[model samples]
Target: MEADMSAGDLDRRVQFRRVTRMNTALGQEETWADLGSPVWASRRDVSDGEKAAAGGVFSTVSARFQIRSSTFSRGITAKDMLTCDGREWEIVGIKEIGRRDRIEITATARTDR
Candidate 1:
């Protein structure tokens, strides 16, 4: 789906974050660090699905975020995660729209931390 990226639709503030792993004496410690200042984005819930694993069903929610293209947004990758409204979304894909006018981020809701 194409996002119009209108000003009103970009109503939510989202922050991009990356995970940093450090090797410690005992083990590896991973931490999430902010990439840049929060930016306005248009967030939409795309779909929800259930995954069956280990004799259980797990629910996952997918979402799409549209943000204006910039230096920071252009550098984003699938390894990055987005935080919005106190929820973390794992980035699944990144696509540039219309000569880099905007970027569409596809992500899945992460409840396992």
Candidate 2:
């Protein structure tokens, strides 16, 4: 199905950065590179999952972002990060809308702390 992304639908502006891993002498280091300009998107909290494991409880908050595909290239993948409202989120999943007209990004942030 196609996503209806009218001007009023996109109420938030978010920036996307591609995550690149470089192998250093010590270990693998991740670097964030700006993909393009900030794009208008509709953001919402998708779900929150928590579980008691080992010593403490593990919790994660998943968020969803809907953006026009034209705003970005097809290079965006799960190895990217989204910055919204001064918070950094790691992209966990991505869904392309019909005909690549829009994209739905599912990201998560640790909330255990």
Candidate 3:
């Protein structure tokens, strides 16, 4: 038996995109193309990690998104990106729950280089 998803759990709308790479004569090009329509997902802050070594200090903001399994397919991977609340997040990890009933995506905010 599988658990049902609560409507209240999915409150935020997020857009998913797959990263596409193309090889050209000059070099490689990458683009983000929409995978499908926007879907409702539950968002939460997972963790905050910091590292201070011999080099400069580094910090990471991690977040999790729970969505219907049907919303995303196997094509979605760590190279993908999610857009929510006018911000873009890079997908770092993905986990399938309860026989693909739902999916949990771990991501970090996309920072400008």
Candidate 4:
């Protein structure tokens, strides 16, 4: 089960992307955007629930995936996000089930770059 990371701290975590119907003129799909973060986020933040709360540019579509969090601290971190080999994410915000509840992985999309 995903853990809640609200009271702890929202730091860099994993990134995810989903396919959108929209693509570049060349038909090439742009899944990520440059929002001062190097991690290439997918279409959906998997756990990204609300929009207004996590203010940022986002794609119309999203997807679901699995990831692991820190065991010592026993939680997820942006540094745990992997793209191909191993990548880090700039956690925009964390969606907590409740106070001190297990935090699930959610993210917001930036502009395609």
Q: Considering every candidate listed, which one attains the maximal TM-score? A: 1
Per-prediction TM-score to the true structure, in the order listed: 0.86, 0.75, 0.74, 0.25
Residue pairs in clash, model 1: none
TM-score of 1: 0.86
Q: List model 4 lDDT by residue over 39-99, tens digit each.
A: 3222334543333435665432233222323232234445343332233333444443444
Cand. 2 TM to true fold: 0.75
- Model 4, 44: alpha-carbon shift in Å? 4.8
Worst 10 residues of 3 by lDDT: 70-79
Runs in model 2 deviating more than 4 A are 1-3, 21-29, 51-58
- CA deviation > 4 Å runs, candidate 4: 1-65, 69-89, 95-103
Q: CA shift at 47, candidate 3, in angstroms?
A: 1.8
What total of clashing residue pairs does each candidate reach?
0, 0, 0, 14
Which stretches in model 3 have alpha-carbon errors above 4 Å?
1-3, 21-28, 49-60, 110-113
Candidate 2's residue-wise lDDT over 1-113, tens digit each?
55367989889999989877899999999888878898899988989999787988888889989888874546788878888887788998898887877888999977755
lDDT of 1 by residue, 8-69 (tens): 98999999899999899989999999998999999889898888889987788899999999
Per-residue lDDT of 12 in model 3: 98
Candidate 3 lDDT by residue in tens digits, 1-113:
76677999899999988878899998999888888888999999978777675886666667999898873455578878999888788898999878878888999873331
- Between candidates 1 and 4, the one scoring higher on TM-score is 1
- lDDT order, best first, reads 1, 2, 3, 4
C-alpha lDDT of all candidate models, in order: 0.89, 0.83, 0.82, 0.36
Candidate 2 overall lDDT versus native? 0.83
